[model samples]
Target: MGGGRWTVVLDPHRWLELRRFRGLYESGAMSLREIAKETGLNRRTVAKYLSGRTPSAPPERAASDRPRRRVVDEVAPLIDAMLRAEILLKGAVIHERLVAEYGFTINYQRVKMYLQEARPRIAEELGISPGELAGLHRRFEVVPGAQAQVDWGDEGKILAHVGIPKVYSFHMTLSYSRDPFCCFTTSQDLATFFDCHRQAFAHFGGVPMSIVYDRTKTVVRRHVAPGEAVPLHPEAVAFAGHYDFDPDVLAAYRPTGKGRVERQVLIVRDHVLAGRAFSSIEEMNAAFTAWVPLRRAKVHGTHGEVIGLRAVRDHTALRPLPQSPYVVAQRHLRYVGKDCLVAFDANLYSVPAFRVRPRQLVEVRATKSQITLHATTPGAGGETLLAAHSRAVGRGARVVDERHWDGLPTGAGRRVTAGGDLPAPLQQRAQDSSSGSLMALLNRAAATQVEVGRRPLSVYDELTGTRPFTTHPNTKETP
Candidate 1:
């Protein structure tokens, strides 16, 4: 308190000096000048610091007692507003904006320091504590196979040169072991989501007791009011049922709940995708597969154990995979064509003529090797099978069954061929024609249709008063 630069709270050493001076003065062993000379202070300043009635101990000053004027002080309200709006603006960005838009003349470092102190207060006002902020995520561990966290990370413009704008990675990490599995996909649709789950399960050699997922639409169908159970997508429920694992969805706006997979997404990006170019999702996935083994061998930072060793314990605790792998078939509503076929995957699949009408909506359930069509029925089961066709291997292929078109008009129905064509009866008749004398026979048969009088050349000769069997007009012998 004696000098502008010193306060008991800000400069505890100066408080110690004050205490020493007070002690020397009280003992009557040293003059104020002597204490000042020893402590390196003016006698008046030393006396001012020692003026307290009985210096017991330096009292800790309240944080509010610190100097109030700051560059951030002028913009604290703005920063508070930004934080309250859930805008995660960086301190440097805020500083630049303050300079450009608000004409703030303060330095960036002061603004940054103020922001660090102000965020806790701002979060408190928003009904969330500083510890719950996005940056101050807490770490928790789950028992082996007790849980696994799933997440998706977008790799932007990864294959832009090959015409792909973006790709996503599905990541799943065992909570206890921190073991991770990731795969790249061009889509985040329900099919791809379920497919990723299967891939991760296969990689881990089994399914976990429960899998935690973000509030993605593929997992959580909708966000319900607080205290109400979060509704899960029906397909997701079916998939979990098939695997005999529970699906745990994190609450809305709480990605840290699935922190294991969230952190692994970053690790995979940095280790596998950083500075890497891929022409296809398959190639990116291959890269991830090759790099994941390296990660598994490294020592985990938090667990302080070899990840592969920990993962061995995880795999042993995981639930055994079902006798059959869960089939994740993509469902789509397709209009049946007039040819008694439904189009799927750029291939035409036959639907029984009696089962589906032209332009009627039929649900196509497509798996890797099969495409099954189901017609919605009014009964309890909801859908009736129309047909199941072998999945086509290439585009523009037509897969048909002859029985499907049994009800078509008589000649309209034809034998099915591997080429997907229905051979017409006329084509069959042409194929059965004899090879020899075909041209001459065709000419003679064509002459049968020509009109000829009964008299023939003799009638023409009598009409002209000429010989009846004249060989030539120029001979004139018969005349």
Candidate 2:
């Protein structure tokens, strides 16, 4: 017995005897000697336990209850501050920063253990549950085709020469199957947004009944009161109408509502973009396409079913696409410049000469590779297509149709090559009209001023005799 504390492993028989003895003693049917003899423990040990004077807890717990002293204890306040600053930072990162900046000499495990105790306090100070404050997310599943999640990820600068261009990936994932489709673009504009949707639907073979979206301006026009229905952008409403899908917007500041897509975005960045270099957007998308099939073939973590097999079930419940594919073009009102050209995407497309007047308001519909200019009001038929040009990919490009400018005239008054040229006789007249008209007019004026004129002012003055006397202002006229 080391210092009267015998740490012995009692057999089951000894435990049974202890309980029986304790029960008999409690009932006042056994003496201390008898109980001790029956239990085989010393009389003192039995008295220690029965008197409620045993060690307050197990020996190990007593040793563990004392606060652990560590090198980090010297900067306990700093650790608390780090926790307050960013609760999500792991102990390894905190330790790294402390060592690098504060010269902390401590192991990572000690910091990790300390953080476990400090986090709940920090969370309490912020008036939130530790779980909520720590962003503990719950997993959710929806019926196949019932919902899909859409989001955009900033991919940093890729095609820098094309413009220090920031690329973004548009990701849409079916919630049930975890099947994801991604497209990369240089913009997040409404046109690009809808274009990605079209591409995603084509890739998936159909559209989900509803698409979950964060409060992006492309979907929600503006923020509204809590619990109120968010107002959808007009273009978005039209797009949803065309696709026959409901737009489900997540509450502001809640990203976990669409965690599947969020997770898939990280998955793509890790598996596709990480440590990979691509010079073009097309290459990135092609890589994604090739990788998608392999990803689908693997068993998903949440569903425990092969993603591709699950997707087969997902596709059956999806809404069918409309007969004619939705025309996803951006329409902008453009002014026809005096050059008989309409400016679009930094390119010029000529309208038929005399067909559209300069400064005329025209609607320019731009698809990925085509630009179509239309008159605001329909002609005798329907919307008049004044011009259509293959969309130029480069800036300052000119897509001119020489036939469109046929009605325009050449330099001076010569008509261009009913090619808007003046008549042959009219050209001859125009050629001579400038100099000939001026010379003929001058000769007529000279003839009119000839000295043999029938009635001159001087002749009339002489005939009258009195008016010829000194009419100059400097000479005084006699009254």
Candidate 3:
């Protein structure tokens, strides 16, 4: 502590220094400046540092001509070897090994600092700070029509009767423009999965040059050769092939690489999905469609103040969408009822009297506008024509033989007597219960009337009353 620039003072020495400084100023033997110079500090700083100080470290070491024992030469080589071998991998481990192997005792903290200064840790201490990650979405800049990013999201529904306040989401973003689109689906089943993408692209007003998607089952094979990526699922691969654009599957576990799409999902979640609800997926989609135009009109963070205009500008470069949105996901298998009616959903629609008894196996390709049925394998009797339903398909409904001559529904009692019109016994059972009763009758009612479709009431009656229903002329039910 003597004459070293102001020393760190401890306990009694600090009290002594303060006393000495006070005594000196009072006695006038030496100016504060002289005391400070002797202490090897400028006057004011010395006063600040030493005025009330007591010497702490056993006085300062006198001038040392000799070097201290070499910590580096003794330990650095072993540390280097461990690092090269990627062993003794951490500072604590290195310190422990040094002591265990060479009796080289070192402070744990000092070793930690030394390792930090000497080598880079390959593993990240922190992949991203939450604040930085939060701001990442703000960092994205996209080009128009060049790329699209996609991910699955939750659907939010208010009164879904399959029973839950459920909603499902499959969302997409334009990579170049950062424009976003999201839609709902009841299932990730192939049909709805592709339908969602179709809806998203249509909302964007164009397809992207490339579509970036995380490897959902719809798109990925789920297995791969070592060091080789898994292939896109055939259905998705086919969809992409049809569009003539690259289908970019993001690397597994690397959201950072697909940060743009990831960011867009958050955009839609915050601006669109959050706090939003719908009576059903259809209603939710209607709301989503309405919001898309507003979102499209918004200015991007890094880009100019307008949106849809640029979308239009870059849209021309995008591959044109298909004339048909179908992905050929249709399956051909006959679903027949015991009464010889075909079953789809829960409804039983009639086939011709000859065609009934056992359901015919027919391949059906369903579209928004048509259900084109084909004879995948003719019935056992070698039925000539696959039946077609006059009414739309629903569960409990049937597709009848086109040549069945429009016979009365099997359960239909006497015909309306006048063809071209239904009979009165076919009228809703006057004794119909508080709930639903029959699928055929209900489907028929639904087909005939929409808003007041007795279908729901009849279904409630059917489902609630009994596990099964009594049989009538054409249809069978539990009593």
Candidate 4:
């Protein structure tokens, strides 16, 4: 055979053969011809493999020399612009915008491939570090009782079989000790959120110096742009002020700021909820209580210390709780209906008819157990408490107090006997007054009065000695 240069491509089978041949040749147990016969390769081929230049790893396949067309090439500039504007822009969002705004017809796979190559280049141009763009963050440590992180997990449909539409898990992790407190709830309202916080503090036996949280509406009044001041909810501020703690709101789009509680959320789900069914929120909470001791006994992977023992240090360092916990209420403004009732939460709570007029605006403060209605504008008497009632458990319920309707008519004056005649008290008042009583004279005078007849204007004018107008028959006009 005429060959300038030859290469042997050793696929897996040939590589194993080469290994066997090397073993046999080194052992000196068989001749090259005999080894070739055993391997079904010619003696020269077997000897060549035994020489062992480790079958120059099958010549790396050369890349294509021809130019290849890509569907995403035309949209490269658009993708680059998006990545530049928001350095953390996701590939899926870029694909969606390309399809919707730019009428792109390429599949997502091509867009994803293009982004895999283009994202780094653009991020580098914008001076964003590769680690930052890759979501790499440095771990932080806090002193005992210095901070606590709070987050909410959507345990959707976990309790749906029991008629609850949704369920949520509130998680609090002490930053230093990795101490965890979680409670299940059916609502995420302002009142329930702080109530859970109070429960967590009670469980920990103290409150941390500060609590970290996401930009939840219950904590933040409104969302602001990055680097702008975040406005805290008035109730949240009041609650924190009462407890002598500060609220730390995490930055927008940054969950790693509170990664401790974030990881605890998953751990809790794995330990307590997986493969377990709960009929009520109370039952779910009880399960968590049972699992806490087990969790505390284990050495934390990050800190390498027993969680319960570390929590002892954490608890000792925390600030003592206030003498009395702050009261949390969800407030709303409603006008009194014509029926003397104010509607809230699909239920009606009554206001005293005398205290609140129809259509008067009032503030409704709803706590866990009671609903209190207060007049928005107190009168000169400075009376604001209109009425209070137990919160209704079911919808379309009307909770009313009978005393609130005391002044309204109840058909008592119009009551009649079985014979269709007035009752005794009304009959006595309606009977004739001829028994020499004081009412008799008034009745006699009224009976003797005569009826007055209609009179013409001329007759009245003549009686009063005044001039009367006379009309001429031909002119038919008065002068």
474, model 1: CA deviation in Å? 62
lDDT of 3 by residue, 289-394 (tens): 7666766766777676566777676666677887876554644466655555655445444545554445557565543333544566566788545555543633
Clash pairs of candidate 2?
415-421, 415-422
lDDT of predicted model 4: 0.80
Which lDDT tens digits does candidate 1 get at residues 238-319? 9999999999887678888887788898778766665445789889889878776677777888889999999999999999
lDDT of 3 at 328: 43
Off by over 4 Å in 3: 1-143, 160-165, 225-234, 255-257, 280-283, 293-299, 302-306, 322-327, 332-337, 341-373, 378-385, 388-479
Q: TM-score for every candidate vs. truth?
A: 0.53, 0.56, 0.46, 0.60
- Give each model's whole-structure lDDT: 0.75, 0.77, 0.58, 0.80
Query: With candidate 1 superimposed using the best TM-score fit, by how many Å does residue 325's alpha carbon deviate from the native?
Result: 1.4
| Backbone clashes in model 2 | 2
Order the candidate numbers by lDDT, best to worst.
4, 2, 1, 3
Candidate number of the best lDDT: 4
In model 2, the worst 10-residue window by lDDT is 54-63
Q: After superposition, how far is residue 435 of candidate 2 from its true place, in Å?
A: 24
State residue 397's C-alpha deviation in candidate 3, in Å. Answer: 6.5
